[model samples]
Target chain A: MQKRNTEITVGMFVAAGIVAIFVLAMKVSNFTDFTDDAGYEVVAEFGNIGGLKVRSPVTMAGVRVGRVSNISLDGSTYNAKVTLSLYSQFNTLPTDTSASIFTAGLLGEQYIALEAGAEEEFLKNGDVLHLTQPALVLEQVIGQFLFSKAEGE
Target chain B: MIDFIRSLGRWGLDTLQRLGSGHLFLWYMVKGIPEVLLRFSLVIQQLQSVGVRSVMIILVSGLFVGMVLGLQGYNTLVDFGAEESLGVLVSLSLVRELGPVVSALLFAGRAGSALTAEIGLMKSTEQLSGMEMMAVDPIRRIIAPRFVAGIISMPLLAAIFSAVGIFGGFIVGYGLLGVDDGAFWSQMQVKTDWYDDVLNGVIKSIVFGVVVTWIALFEGYDASPTSEGVGRATTRTVVHSAFAILGLDFVLTALMFGEI
Candidate 1:
């Protein structure tokens, strides 16, 4: 009976371990999505997106409202096109709400930062964001400095 | 002086002989793995003994490690005005390196020593000889099951260590420290990749499991069936497994993520 209890507890231990791993994998790594994930899509274009990836959060005034749903290259315009998924609660972004890619902190992940515009009209699904500021490339900034210094020399 | 030199030479020869014989023992023990499949009870019992019983130590150690990371990472990051990235540092460190390497070290000390001692005790008790007299292969029944169990339990223990460690970090970072709860989790999600970071960690733990268990069983099976021998074997298991875990960790890290 004592051995049986240890076995049961051991079973529970293994089960709990597995459950914890499942939660970490699915929740943090996003291996699965059970939610309806109710949200609408909006698109923005930029000239450069440094280290931006799909599923990058879209934040409005420092609050996460959605995520980057897709990224593509505009062949003709030579621009980067990004699709944003705005959650149903945060669907009130004005048509002119500008999107810009920014780093959250120094040496941190890249995310899309949204700035709400004063327009009374709100953006809808498949609507394109007219104003976008490209991602700031730190390497480009450093390279520019080096070139300028060389010219001065 | 000449007599002492001859004795020293004999001692060196004995050590070499033991090493060669021990290698053979390990080889034969591993070869019994196929036989283990037909005898599931043996493996299950050892898994419970080795993996399940060792959970508390792994968890407590993992929790402390995460708390340390949270506390230390917060202080260092706050200096750079990036305290919110605590989750990133904690999860990445735990998942990538500490989870596998530390847990293996702990497992070596806990389960590895226990395994060596138990097997050594069993040998000294003549139970192995009794089985052999009954025309049963002790290697097939005894060592293989424990070996297989260690291999199975190791990765699970590692995963548990990492997952719980992350929670410990959450407690320290969100509950104690003033980091924003959302930012802590969101930052981790954004930063950590499943394949490159998480899967590689699991792989590392699996590798550690195989190597550590192999050493534990090898030391036990090869130790002379005596009290002093058992004690020595147990010590060797811990020392050998620790060194192997560290050396393997460095090599695995380099192969998985290093520029070279």
Candidate 2:
């Protein structure tokens, strides 16, 4: 009886350990929203990524509608091609919908934010989003600020 | 006054030269390596007896540590309006620094002192001498098991500590602290590098195990075979091992962070 009790306790501890590891892995992997949201694929190109990585959210008007699926660079153009999986239910994105790389907050993570365009035609799977803004380089912004300040002086 | 100043300066130079040779320490380390490894294996067996048997205490302590980290981190970050970053803060701090160090310290306090005292008592009773008459190597027979146990128990305890702590943090942070589960995890996913934190923790545990076990064994082996000697050895094992752990932590941190 004592042996059986000890075995049960050991089993319980092992089970708890396994559960904790699973929880940690799930948390670290961002395994939320595993249920497929209705979505279609669209592509955008940018000159610089600025720590923007795959699996980053694609937000429309501050609401996450999709996520970055893949990031690759065009061999000849030297442009980064970012593939976004947008929810199919939100088909309001026009053909001219523009994408911009923006930070969530000051010193926060970067995400691809979409600005819906006024055009009537909706974007389709495999559609290339032509109206795109690249990441704002911090050095460029600081340099511009300094240069403008110097000119004002 | 001139002679005093000159002597003080000479003493300082000699101290610097001794510190610079550091090879003397390295030689001692080399000489100890084989004995350490043998003792390490024996310590592993002892862990089966001591640590694996003490699962309840380790579990409860680990959970509490995790819960505290989460609750405290949440409150602090919320004050700054960065509540969502609780996951990153908890996971990084636990896995990188707190988990292994805290668990090892606890293990040393519990099992380390016990090992030292047990060996010290055996020495005082002349059981160690009896083993020597039987041609049994006391270092391998007596000291090795505790040393091996210490090394094994530390990593296992560290792993449990991290796992429980993360879970506890999650429970408190997400359940009570009002941080959204999704936001918490997303922040963690973005900030954490598994190789950097988890692997670093394991490496630290290995080094900690070595240091704690070695100190315990060394003290026991050198015990004066008297009651007073046993008491002194036990105290030294705990005190010296604690200092060694702190010093090695600094060295490892510097090396891991590329300060070396």
Candidate 3:
């Protein structure tokens, strides 16, 4: 009985180690977020999304309040339709809040940053954020810079 | 010129002889596997010696490796103004490469050398011969359990090493360096792939486990039954296991990454 107990314990330890590795791998690689957080949804339209991806964090005043749930293209307008899943508590965002896709740091990741404005009306589900800004494409900026430099030279 | 040619010829012959002996020794080890199922207690005892005891060293080294990566990754990423990616950098390095390679090297140094010395000492004492006289196969009763334990322990140890190392990286990246905690985690969580980084690491460590254990046991079994011979075998186990691990890692990595 004692010997069997020892073996069982050892087996458990190994099993525990394997589980830890799985969690660490997922956590490090960002495969699954534990909190599949429940939240409300809103829509925004952009002329260009650049390289923004689904699940990209939506921030307000530099704090993450939601994530990009889905991104698609409108057939007529050629605009990108992005769905934002904001946390339930952050549903108090005013209807006049401006949404923009901004790059972090100099060349870091891109995210949807929201700048709130004064409005008595609060945003609700299915509401569209009217004021939207598009991402600044680096290639275009570099191209313009080279063109200006060539003209100056 | 003739002398140089003759010495080179002799070295080649010597290597062939060692390789032949190692192969035969592995055969003997494998022949004992059926007995392991009946002698489960032996496997457990060996597991305790090989796995449970080595946890401390593996954890400490893993922690240090992570800390070094976190600190260095921060410095480099800061130049690009992207320090927030530290979590991804540290975890990816540890899981994909450093975790398996470094842990195997440490295993060879600590457990591999010890197994060789213990088995060599047992042979010198004539216990193996004594067991044979009593109608017991020492390979089945003695060596197989240790072999099984080693193969089982190594991958788990590597896993533990990688897991703890990430936390060490976390402390250095978020706690000390002031990288945004949210960005540190969310960026890493979103970017890391389960199959490419994590599974590959586990596979690499499993291969390492087999190689290190095989060399250690074979060296011990083939050791001359004397104190000096036992010491030499122990030393050879460490050196050969380390070399085999590095060589195998290169081949395995190439096979995994190369498209052709």
Candidate 4:
């Protein structure tokens, strides 16, 4: 009976451990989304990507629909070529959809924000987004303001 | 100066000799694995002792650690008006760093010390010598099972610690502080990647488990078969395990996340 009790208690402890790991994966981290790998990749060219990183979320109308899969430089154009992997369910984004970099909160993470266009043709895998706004560089914005003020004087 | 140099040289040589024997001890434990597996009941018994018994400490400490993190994190983040990131702050810190590290430290103090004392006592009592006289390999019959149990239990305990810690953080952040539930959870999910944070934490705990158990078993096995020796071995187990966990954590973190 004592031996049986040990086994029972040990079994419960092991079960609890497994359940805890499951809870962490499901609720705390993005493990479920990891398994949902059905997605289409589209490329966008930006003048500057700023702090945009790989795996940064791509949101349409402030709702995340995709993530930045890759970021590289186009040697010829000197543009930042970013590959966005949109989930299969969000396949209806129009061909003319515009992509822009937006910062979350004050001094927060940067993400790609997509604005849908009124076009009949939908974007497909490997399609390029023509309308892309670069990330807002604070220094450049200040520089432009100073230059404009000097010009006005 | 000559005497100091001679002592330093002796210390270095001693350390080297111990390092060589530790490796051999680990190899013997590995060699005994097949026999240990064949007699799986032994492993289960050790599991009950090491893992099952330690659950209470792991859970309670985990909860308190998490609550403290939530409170401290909220206080700091609130000043910046970023209290909505309480989930991200708590979950990331717990999953990435605190979970495995703190649980490993506690495990060393609790289970690791216990293991050393138990084995050291067995040695001092001449039970191991008796088994050897009966043509039994005590390494196979005794040490391997406990070693294997420690390795298996460490990761599980760490995971439980992290999970419970997250729940405790939620209690403080959402239940008490009224942080928006949706924002808290969504931000955590968005920021905490499974592969990077959770999986890495598990890997860290596994490594810590192996090292802590190895140190405990080695110290116990090498004890001088006296009461005083066993007590010293137990103390060494906790101190050495703590130092090893912290040192290895730094190296592992650099390799896993440094990107350099």
Best by TM-score: 4
- Cα lDDT for residue A68, model 4? 96
Model 2 misses residue B185 by how many Å?
2.8
What is the C-alpha lDDT profile of model 1 across B1-260, one tens digit per residue? Answer: 99999999999999899879877877887799988988776777787899888899998999999999999999999998988889899999998999999999999999999999998888999898899999999888898899888888888899889998998998999999989989899778767777778889889999999899988988887778999999999999999999999999999999998969
Candidate 1, residue B28: how far the Cα is off, in Å: 2.6
Q: Write one digit per residue (lDDT tens) for candidate 4, span B1-260.
A: 99999999999999999999999999999899988999988998999999999999999999999999999999999999999999999999999899999999999999999999999999999999999999999999999999999999999999999999999999999999999999999999989999999999999999999999999999999888999999999999999999999999999999887897
What TM-score, to 2 decimal places, does chain A of model 3 have?
A: 0.83
TM-score of chain A of each: 0.79, 0.80, 0.83, 0.93
Cα lDDT tens digits for candidate 3, A1-153? 877777877887688678768777666764454255677899999999988988788999999898898999989999999999998879789999899999976676789999998999999998999999999999998999999999999
lDDT of 4 by residue, A1-153 (tens): 988988898899889999989999999999988787669999999999999999999999888898999999999999999999999999899999999998986589899999999999999999999999999988889999999999999
lDDT, candidates in the order shown: 0.87, 0.76, 0.87, 0.94
- Encode model 2's per-residue lDDT on A34-131: one tens digit a residue: 45665789999999888798778899999989989899999989999999998888887899999999987777778999998889999999999998
Residue pairs in collision within model 1: none
| Error of model 3, residue B257, in angstroms | 3.4
> How big is the positional error of residue B155 in model 4, measured in Å on the Cα after superposition?
0.9
Q: How big is the positional error of residue A136 in model 3, measured in Å on the Cα after superposition?
A: 9.6
Q: Candidate 4 clashing pairs?
A: none
